[model samples]
Target: MLPTRYVRHSPPKETTTSSVNEPKISVQVLVLGDIGRSPRMQYHAMSIAKHGGRVDFIGYQESTLNPGLVENSLITIVPLQPPPSLLRSNTLPFIFAGPLKVLWQIWSLYYTLGYQTKPARWLLVQNPPSIPTLFIALIICFFRNTHLIIDWHNYGWTILAGTKGPTHPFVMLSKHYEAILGSFAPTASFTVTNAMAKQLRSRPYNVRSPILTLHDRPAAIFQPISNSEARRAFLARIPETSGFAAAIMAGETKLLVSSTSWTPDEDFSLLLTALCHYAESTDKLPPILAIITGKGPQKQMYLDRIASLTSTSKLQNITVATAWLTAQDYATLLACADLGVCLHKSSSGVDLPMKVVDMFGAGLPVVGYAAYESWEELVKEGINGRGFTKSEELAAVFEELFADREGKQLARLRKGAVEEGSRRWDEEWDSVAGRLFGLCD
Candidate 1:
């Protein structure tokens, strides 16, 4: 059972720090998410596993399980299901089943707890603390002599609400939980994008605490290819690519769009309008292929918004790719695209994203509109990508990036950045295996 809600996710003001001398502990990994289908951290964790250590997976069965995972790693998967009600679509009578879904994750976690063994050296808890399975793992780790590790993928506690830096009761409220979790988990570390890491280290949370972990995944390679040959292959697989791209070519200029899977709060409607205006005035419409990879709760809302926007503005090229694609193909397309988009609402809980890193890894740049410190940090002003908070600022930035020789130059620089990002990954977690596990020096 969850501990009594004494602090209500709030922590004391007294700050804490870790000694420079690293503490020793036995390490084993316990993961959440539909292990097979979870593309983001699952792969990163597996990458760490390849570095040499034991990786045990506790996840549900998914329809599109990666064949590679089953073939490659010695991962142990635990099958658990959310109540069937969670997966089934809700009806109008119910209004919203948001709370019900959250309950379902927690319910599954309860079962995950029963399957666990006592104590390992390291316990990586990917969160929102949404699922009961994770909490159970935390408790089990606590009992079995394992220290809990927080990946701050959720940063749920630090959520702010808008384009500006911080705001109102939300900020104050978020601060309380951030501190509480800071003290509560000794082995905590944040896997934040550059912007978040920079902010947490300098402003809110200090670095030495070992609580702020930078999630330094390699960036995608963004290279421009006028591929006549590969284009055919891409078109064949992408079905409707010819008509979609062609129609959109005359269809919309500078199409402002967003991913469908992202929550509605991080909506890019205002930004889309700005992009539309930029195109109208400049005669350079930036067509958008808004590929909403993976279905999430907000998919329908996004589709509706996209449909509405396209119909009114009658923007030509703004299209959506809702179909599932293999991970490699997914990476390839994102890397090949003109630009990638992301938005982090102030109300965003733990706004860490694998896409931001993957964007950079694929050598593609990202344009992020962030409220809290997350993907926003990755856009180094004139460097890897653009980070915007205001809708007004977006079109101008996008135009600047797409215009002349400068845009191509920027793309190259962004691609070059992937090297440094890869180095960061190797540097940060290179010794993670040795440290977490009793591996060789």
Candidate 2:
């Protein structure tokens, strides 16, 4: 038998503010990742705070929180302690134990909320680590009468499928479980792209609540910098590059930057191959410095590959550097680069890469690898950047962009990148957030 589809008859109405005498609205944001790393959730929290709500942000602890967020009186951060080493190291046990801990903490918070004065209460949760967490949240919301709002990034099942293949029993179970839970009617739901929104709407259990697209945007800190200034800053940050200082100072060097998650989904090997092709294709090519950012499970594997290339002298003229940069340093590094290479082939082919957005915000032209069609929205060939399927095609695109003797092509692409990047997607979040928090009139 086909599953019944739940549908909403009306779109969400604008939420109005209470009278001056009334208590302010309150929100509890639940995320399984580091709040510092989850920019979308952070933006939503900031928006709620901006609109006179008290936001309780609950998430895993990190080394630091955003300084501006820390200063916001309307927001209080509660960090979740990590699980014990035994559970953390065992994948299956951690999966079951982790959500149980989150459920307990949330229940404790719910108990605390009972003592507080009456106000509009909402729970905004980020998903994938989705299933058991959302399922638990639904139970709590049922008892507390708090409105639930889910920000869908991708299905936890799809992520599992990436690692464990589609036919795995766990993957199949997760997929079925997510569909069932995702269909419960919430106050509203949001996703990062229109494609993702469409996918969520099509879910059988989806109770047709208003699902809106909330695209990721670069923060204000990512602005354009002069090549000279950026190069100087880059050199200062990594003093080991003093050997290339003379070449960079003389304008005989090009900087290529790639931001990656270092996962299998992103084929960094393809990018390394492209670089080797770029080197061997032309002797006239100037010295190239490549900076690959972000740290993940596959960092050592890529580092070993880079070392192999170095030892073989295959890329003697090309210097590759990798670092896991802080937000501030990452932004600065993006601003200094000549070109950005995005190796991300989306794991689910639904979520767009925010790294490309940050790169564009820094006015850096990107050559991206597209696993699906939706990527075209960002990497428009000849408009802002180019997209490719194979290493050779990407190498060819790189050759054209970097090997231009007259410099006209590079200048034009840079202009396109800056123009396209200057459009602020972040500004749209304020209105969407207002609607989500019932702060809008």
Task: Compare the candidates by lDDT and give the number of the best one.
Answer: 2
lDDT of each: 0.52, 0.74
RMSD values, in order shown: 8.3, 5.8
lDDT of 2: 0.74
Among all candidates shown, the one with the greatest TM-score? 2
TM-score of 2: 0.86
Candidate 1 per-residue C-alpha lDDT over 161-231 given as tens digits, one digit per residue, 9 for 90 to 100: 34224655545655655645544554656555545444545535554455455555552232333464563
* C-alpha positional error of residue 322 in candidate 1 after TM-score superposition, expressed in Å: 4.2
lDDT of 2 by residue, 1-441 (tens): 111121112332323454323325778787777788787788777777776777788777675677667998878887665545554555556458656655665554443333332223777889877755677667656655678888887778888788879998878888888887887746788887788888777754454888888777777878888757656857666654556665655657887889887898888999899889887884577778888877678899989989999899888688898776677777877776778998877767888888888888888888898768469767778878888889899878877876776667767778888887886655767667676555764
How far out, in Å, is residue 227 in model 1? 7.2
